[model samples]
Target: MKKLLQIIIGLGFILTPFYTNAHVKWFTEVAPKKESIENILSPLFMGLALLAAVVLASLTIIIPKMAQMPLIKKWDDYLSGFRKYSRYLLKYGTAVALIIQVTNGTLFAPEFQLDSTLLTVLAWVTIGLLLVPHHIATKLGASILLILFIMVTVKHGIFYMLDYGFYVAIIGVLLVGSTKLENVGFPFLYLGTGLSLCWVAVEKWVYPTMSLDIVANHQVPTFGFEPAAFIVMAAFVEFVVGYLLVVGILNRVLGFVVTTIFILTTMLFGFTEIIGHFMIHIVLIIFIIEGVSFYNPPIKMHKTRVDQFIFIFLNFIFVLSTFVLIYYRFA
Candidate 1:
């Protein structure tokens, strides 16, 4: 067991440099070109997909037992104590992200510039409401944030705005946090953000050229793999992160690793990286603090190890195929 933990940690250290969370579309001018279906279904892609499914399924089965270890349990308990502050962290962190966007003349992300004066004013108003310290004010702030999102959708099509779906989830978190159903907010947050990330990972497969272009433009290290292969591995890494979030596995540990990877990217991508991922960083911190306290993860329902493994393996394949095919068809 100790050896297994060491191997996982070692692999994480090796892969950390390649695990980029920056949305390629935000950094590159993506052409309308799509990867050939043949390439999408290549041996390499399918093999990696299967490998990822097996690895994640194994984690889903193993992580519960690992969590019961004296050291892990103690650390998790310490982190779980901060669950009460999850809402505050999300709220204020979003406030800071909005402030950065407003100052930079953008909306939800750096790519979507503020195209009109109304959006600029609304952005400021949303920030003000977020700062007001009252539940009503925060709800109003979330409402305005929704309005801003809709406005962006109107300007750009729904397809473009889907990349920012996590913002909608954030708004949901804020709105629900003030209601009697506040407990549901975190699970909703988890679902929305997780699905959003999974959706975005599809883009890397469908539009590999964009990611490859970003790698070339930014001189990102590939660590000896071809750029294409690296992108595949990177996308898989991101998809697994999102999947674990949805299933509530390794909440704090995943949060810590992903947060570290994002911070490392800033050294390569600079202020733009920080601006693009600031809200994500905040949400990860919340994950580290909350550690699945309010939710019963799906994998936990299967009592036997064999049942859990089968459930995770099949579930991963279904989700991966569904997402890839749907995104390809749309693209």
Candidate 2:
């Protein structure tokens, strides 16, 4: 058990900078286009849109009510017993995500591949360390990841790298890896994800063109809205959900919904989406079951409503203006 703890700690380090690969729509690696709502709507599309809204509304009303049923509650209680395995999931999943990224030659983007064969090889080594399932090996993996992330950051600059969202996964790895801090790993992971979602949303805000390309290419079904509006609204949803995760609000429902969305996306986009969002899927799974922490995490995080609001506001500005300014100045 002690050795396992060490492995977990080491695994944490391996997750340092989880940049979305060049083709990944979830984390970054962007797309979408500018077909206006005014231009695209027809009677059939309008009917479909209304049907979608009705279905969404119905599900919103129904699923939670069903979740509270005795059988469902019993099942949830049963699942709670196995939540401990999420520890392994977090560690191994990170390794696999790294493997996918390395194999693809981009962080998560097949389009934005690394030029250096050496870095590619090093990424494989990181995967090997994650698979070791021991602290010492995991530590080695983390160390390697740290170096990789740092190198990437230096080249990309501190201001506006979409890869920065990887910090949450890093925190999860370290927290769960530590004997002293393992219990709080889930919360910190949630915080990291929240921050990541908001940060990625900024990418859409600044680079709407990238989002437009994605929406159009994916045939993501914008209902009657302009593709660009859909992209912006999608970013908002991403930001709010991340905020909710960070603030520990409606965590289970949000997690479950997000996980379902990712699953649907994987089906839509196939193997690349699977590779790109593997880590995200694991974290959401954890959130769906774990919901929040077993302990107070991040050392004095969110003790009150005011604290949550303050965090939400500050993070919003940080993700929005901070990145936008960097983009205008640097890129």
RMSD of each: 6.1, 8.4
Count of backbone clashes, every candidate in sequence: 0, 25
Pairs in clash, predicted candidate 1: none
TM-score of each: 0.91, 0.69
Candidate 2 stretches with Cα past 4 Å from truth are 1-72, 108-112, 295-331
lDDT of 1 by residue, 3-66 (tens): 4354336433533323247788878886857988898888999999899889887886677777
User: All models: lDDT?
Assistant: 0.81, 0.59
Best by lDDT: 1
- In candidate 2, position 128 carries an lDDT of 87
Query: Where in model 1 is the C-alpha error above 4 Å?
Result: 1-20
lDDT of 2 at 107: 68
